[model samples]
Target: MSKIALFGPTALELFGHTVHAPLQRRAITSERAAEFTPSKRVLDHVHSTFPFLSRPAHITVFDRKHRRQKYARCHLGTPALLNFDFLHVGDGILAPPPEVALVQAMRGRSVIQAAAQGSALCASYSLHADSPTIIQREPIATRASLEMVTRSCSSIPGCKTVRNALPWILPHAASPREIALGLVLFLPVRLGGYGLPRPTLNFPIPTGKHPGNLADRRYYVADLCWPHAHLIVEYDSDAFHLTSDQHYHDIVKRTTLESMGYHVITVSRRQLNDPSEMDKVAACIAKALQKEWRFRVRDFPTRQTQLWTILGLAPNR
Candidate 1:
């Protein structure tokens, strides 16, 4: 039988054990001197074996019935070490050595590291296959996984606004699958539909000559171009309008392009949801193209007065 040590009050009560006479005398003697004085070799062994327990506030030694006495602590003790392979810890399971009890004690509070939490712990156990496996397989309950899943979900555009409302909307969704379903159904309708054209979605608008300008910095390059009109169409989604910085930058770019005789049309998320909006936008583009083509054909002024404003130059005849 493995020798078990009972540390705290609860451990002693459960195991029906008491502190060893010699260890208790040592504790009393150390307390009288107002300092602990365990042998250097014992202290060194403890420091090497269980690093976290080295400077704990208080320590005790307890003997289990029919078992040798082992060390305990007022602050930290694992259920495995307390009752000699009998009492299970957080998940109410007994684990074995080299699977060392000290390791379990240190990580008892962390649900992710607990054996009962699932395959993650199982994988860790497999890696240390030579170590003794904990006998009891109780599941450790923790909110960490749920929090991580929620954080990832919130990073998406429409989902950002609906994160707080998720629990109320779907209380049963503790796992990612249920949360994903809820997000799919709730987000699109809640934040409004995806209005932009899927084909041109996220296409970049390239600034022709001065690519280094701030106005062109954030824009992406699209394959399609209306070179004659210098027009660029950007299909905007909620994601595009996420931050004030992005929104302001987009406005500046649009103004700069328009000033350079380029007609820039931004199809926002809301406008895209309307079926007739695309037709209206298309008509505007056609008119702009016709105007540019007509000017080229008639040999009229190719540059507009807006170019002077855009380039910060004085208008000349």
Candidate 2:
């Protein structure tokens, strides 16, 4: 059986399981510290194998039974590290897989917090992943691995939020802002989301520039596109888009796309500061959808949250 250890930021970083978005960690209070020491045998094994972790910070491991011991105190009910893909961190000693560590790292937190962390993990490899601090060196979780982790999260209680948020976490989101934009638009209004259909990310459209000339052919990659809705949304970063040359090019690109019958909407960081502003943003998209095609919004999937049921949350409640 895989050995379970004390889960914390140091262990996660050592295992390379950081996220692009920020989430809360369960603070280790003095009371929790008594149960937080690593087994001498496990400590020796880890030190012998991965000495770098020892230098940066002290390591901790606890008997798996300690998980049940703190059913009420730890609240997260022992870090969920079962059947995890152990990484061979040199020597024979193994570390928890990045995906598993992510789940464990957010243990004892609310569903939204956990899902936000998971969303950051899901978006890590997307074209727009974001982290204010150092760049992560470990590989992000793949779709398959993410799906596996989502399923496994059900084994823990109060994880419905994480499962519910999975469908909204797109792997193609170019950045955290873009993900925020899409979620703002696609998530149900009741959840403080726009309640619209999911939009495509980094959608590629042929620009028809030198089409036959393979070398000179060009394409306009829309940040968020809904082909059927004929709507495109872009989150503009001043640092990236304010240059004179870039501004001129953007005008030409938008003109070309508009001429092709695509309605483009550009949003800035300032605009997304609050719910009222985001509501106005969604209104703009809704108005465009109505004016362009006269198509009605599809019936919202009320049961879009069956995964919550899988996670032992009541569907009716």
Candidate 3:
């Protein structure tokens, strides 16, 4: 049996040799080692088992100059090597020529930066690997809902006239209603009076009379015309509801909107698991519509205007 004698000056080297020698010899040729150091397969195995290694790591090894000079000159804080493997392409090697080591370190830093940015982007868009490219491409419930809404809208008694007249009438309607219609029509899921199994409604109501007033506005604006009749739906998650301030703010906003005639309906994190929440929300909306229209026809009043003011409007007044 041929035995290999692997020697290193430090504990890290000794450990590396003991753990990596076999895999390095098997995967990489001695000739290849002359040009570029071979990566140990064992490192790949370890990284796969511990996915956390994808995180940034700062490592320093003694320079080859110190190794050759027999400790004649020792430098502190000067890295001999910096090993980083963001792609998990085996254990990285950065030896000699501080410039090379610096370059490798920067590359590693860039990988971490890119990863953090990618994570932020994915989180912001609620992107998922399994999401469909198009509404019709989605699973049965989603496809059915969209088809039903489109078919129903097209088949309405005077749909063509309504669609043709929409461009003109839309501009005259309240900004909130216009925004709500746009959001519903363009949303990934079907919404608005759609008699589908699971329907969602979104309100993209406008805020502020001027740009400056837009700052720090409420999360949502309600349509006061049919306050209790209109449902304000929210998609909640641990991330959004994490802080006490956030929770309190949401509560206050919901209460204010409710006071103005809107019925705020919250969808819990777990409720999204069952598709029936869609139908439940829709039913609640239908029932609310049966009540009297509380929103004033003339114009939406300020917060100080009581509901009584609208109710007292005389037929000719």
Candidate 4:
């Protein structure tokens, strides 16, 4: 078992697929390649159980040549060595840290796709570490991580778009819908989203001047909040917020938010799912924002975006 560091999609899937699953199989092994070698029994067992694994395991040697690459060095963080016979190609191999693997996987993808994937990954798991790649780690650092992947992306030949989209990905998103709402609101209007100012997810705002102690305080946690704009957007999914009690609570919450001088906007699954309807909804949001927005944040145009603009990524607003 020669230790090696595996990365890319396979590593991301391996590291995160079962982070909280009941049957976690990932295990730590020898820190150095010279210290470990797979036994015959281990190899046989892995071969036998390979078919039943959630995903096929693939491993590769992390050679010195790779370490010199800028992206490789910037993206690859602390790696953990593991033993799973199927993942071993020839001998001792290790895997890149989860963050490293994710950045490696983002290579060659479109900006929209990469941003969506990165933000979704953030929502699904914690990817932050004290590693140099990330600064000011998010609260959910226990769930997913972030690092200099954005900077690394910028240095890559075709990753300018990915680099520009980096600021849009949020580590605080709690669900896929929330991530989508962020994309729809921050992605340039040409991309079919509203191009509104980026907002905070699951933002808590106090309802009263002194909302009791922290434990007893009343808060209206908006799905998305633009505090400066004094606006909140709530994705009212039928599956979760359609109950009578939830509905009543929502009515009261909206009233309270309005009383607090915050404009409340409710979005539904139906409108988000349809292009024409989504556009209308976005228009309504634009109107609201126009009324209150003293300043707005739009995607900063990058070289890739300038080229995209010329190529018709979206018409100038």
Candidate 5:
């Protein structure tokens, strides 16, 4: 087995197994990296073999000896070098386990982006694939697994980032857009969300008793649900949701939930794109939950803007 484990964004790209976005890695992945630590000559030999490791983006690796190089950003000490875990994806190329890879991936990511990634790790689908449709797989890791690793590395800087990230994590989130909605709505008010209580993503409510459920759909899965409040917020993504048949399906689902005495709220991509519109939607939901939705912070606007930047929801200047 190769000891040249990929770390950082290079790992993330190969699934540091994170997201669906295009990854133009500036870092390197060397098969010869297995023999990287013996000497300068060995390292040079290893590095030279991978002519394709020419990307300009930084990729992290374990290099305590601190050998100088163009692309590798070495993690000299702490967890990445000593305590983290790894697994083989294929071809004898070892990769840091999901929990470890996620910890490494968070180094350069904004808070919301990292939270989404962490949550995605707990999900049951693969974001990295050649097909447009996300494929189903056993969850690569769990919130508990991440927590275990984070606690083990508490003294490390990345651990604190992971700690800060815990509050916003929605372990059951199903899509990137769903993650965006959860962060914007449930993240603390200081972090640019409305400060709503965290909701369970894709919570299943049994409809087995309702005879009117003639469609034989046995469960109504809420995109974001506050079970205690019986409130659900559904994200109607712009993709595949604009069709007439999908619109009818949504109407039926909303009516079905309302009939069951649950308050249903819908958030569309357009509303999420426009902050003012989203605020109105938040207000409507808050009214349903009997919570006052108001901001008292003086720099709230600037902070929320930064949050937008973090979420990649802000428009380009």
Candidate 6:
């Protein structure tokens, strides 16, 4: 048997999928993998149960008591404070708790990458690197959970970055695109933020009755809303074109919001792809909020490019 090995992205990935459903970790292919690694029997059982684990480029081992020069790292602080957990992957792998794993994964990542991933962690979705890339429904972790972990692991790598990102992570993000949209809009200007105020995600407001519904619902939820500004931004996806019912429902919601004296802006993938169009949306937001539209940072253009590049909005990067 090898010593208990595994941490970092592997652990984050492990807990991430587990948040949705139990999954197995990839096997360690060596004898000297660690001081006390998961036994082959445990690995075999997990592989037989879940045969498809991601094979990382390198193996990672974590020592709760000591550190090694190459593969293993000394655990940060205490296990109790870190809230370390384990998975069935050979029964000895260290699967850091969702919150801790999330912050640890942020080590050396750029602000946008860290913030985007942090938001996704708190979101009711799971983003994957492979096909079907995003799973939307269950929230794997939350800002408050991450905050608790970071507070205890303050000296750990990436904890500060995660702490800086907490204020921007909203709750109940419905889709990957929504997460991207929110970050691009609300992150601080220093981090490629558009200087927009924080808006509640899927915020519900009383809009009185609408004829489009059988229930004559008196409230409608806005995709991204600034209550004080009375403005809402909705991402209009292609689904509306294919689903008449959804389209009609959205139309009614927009009409209701508009009738209630609120300014509404509908953003689409097409508009997002067009640089000038996004600027126009930002302008609309500024006008609604009654704020001057200006970039305070000296290297605003460079930071903006870096932000989009990290967010994957840069096509040529």
Choose the strongest candidate by lDDT.
5
Cα lDDT tens digits, model 3, 1-317, are 11111111111122211211122312222332232311234233333533443222233223333222221212221211222111112333322221122222223232222212211111112112233221111111122232233243342222233222222111111222222222222222211212212122334443324433422364564322232345555545344646887877666666655554456666444433332453354355445555322323333222112211221211111
Off-target runs (Cα >4 Å) in candidate 2 are: 1-80, 88-95, 106-111, 124-139, 142-144, 157-159, 209-217, 239-241, 291-317
lDDT of 4 by residue, 1-317 (tens): 33334446655544433333222223443444423333344334433433232233333332333333322222232233232312432234344444444556667766666566566556544323222222222332222245454443334333455455566676567665677767766766445445677778888888766332222237878888888889898987674647877677777788778877889988887656554565567677778778332223354333324423422333232
Q: For model 5, how many clashes? A: 5
lDDT of 3 at 57: 22
Error of 4 at 294 (Å): 18
* Better model by TM-score: candidate 5 vs candidate 6: 5
Per-model TM against the reference: 0.25, 0.61, 0.27, 0.61, 0.80, 0.77
Show how many residue pairs clash in every candidate, following the order shown.
5, 3, 2, 23, 5, 7
Across 65-173, the per-residue lDDT of candidate 1 in tens digits comes to 2122133232323222332233332121122221122222323232211211222111111211223332222212113333333354332222232233223232222
Q: Give the worst 10-residue stretch by lDDT in candidate 2.
A: 69-78
Candidate 2 lDDT score relative to the true structure: 0.54
Give the range of the ten consecutive residues with the poorest summed lDDT in model 6: 56-65
Reference-based TM-score, model 1: 0.25
Cα displacement (Å) at residue 192, model 1: 24
State the lDDT at 162 in candidate 2. 53
Clashing pairs in 6: 2-36, 2-37, 3-35, 3-36, 3-37, 4-36, 4-37
Q: How displaced is residue 32 in candidate 2, in Å?
A: 24
Candidate 2: the clashing residue pairs are 38-61, 128-174, 128-175
Per-residue C-alpha lDDT of model 5 across residues 1-317, encoded as one tens digit per residue:
22344555555555523343222222223433434343334334334543333243233345555445544555543433454434544333445666766777676566776687787777656653444466555566678888888877665556667767876788876776787888888888777788987789889987656656633366888999999999999988674647887777777778778878789888988888777788889899888888977898888777777777777685322
Sort by lDDT, best first: what order?
Answer: 5, 6, 2, 4, 1, 3
Residue 18 lDDT in model 2? 38
What local lDDT does model 4 show for residue 306?
A: 41
Candidate 6 on 1-317: residue-level lDDT in tens? 44454455655655444436335433333333344433445445434443445543112443443443333343433333323433444444435456766666788876577677777666776655345556665776777887888888876688888888788787777776787778878887888668788878878887655454332366887888998888899988665465777767877777777877789998898766555567788888888888788888998667777777777674322
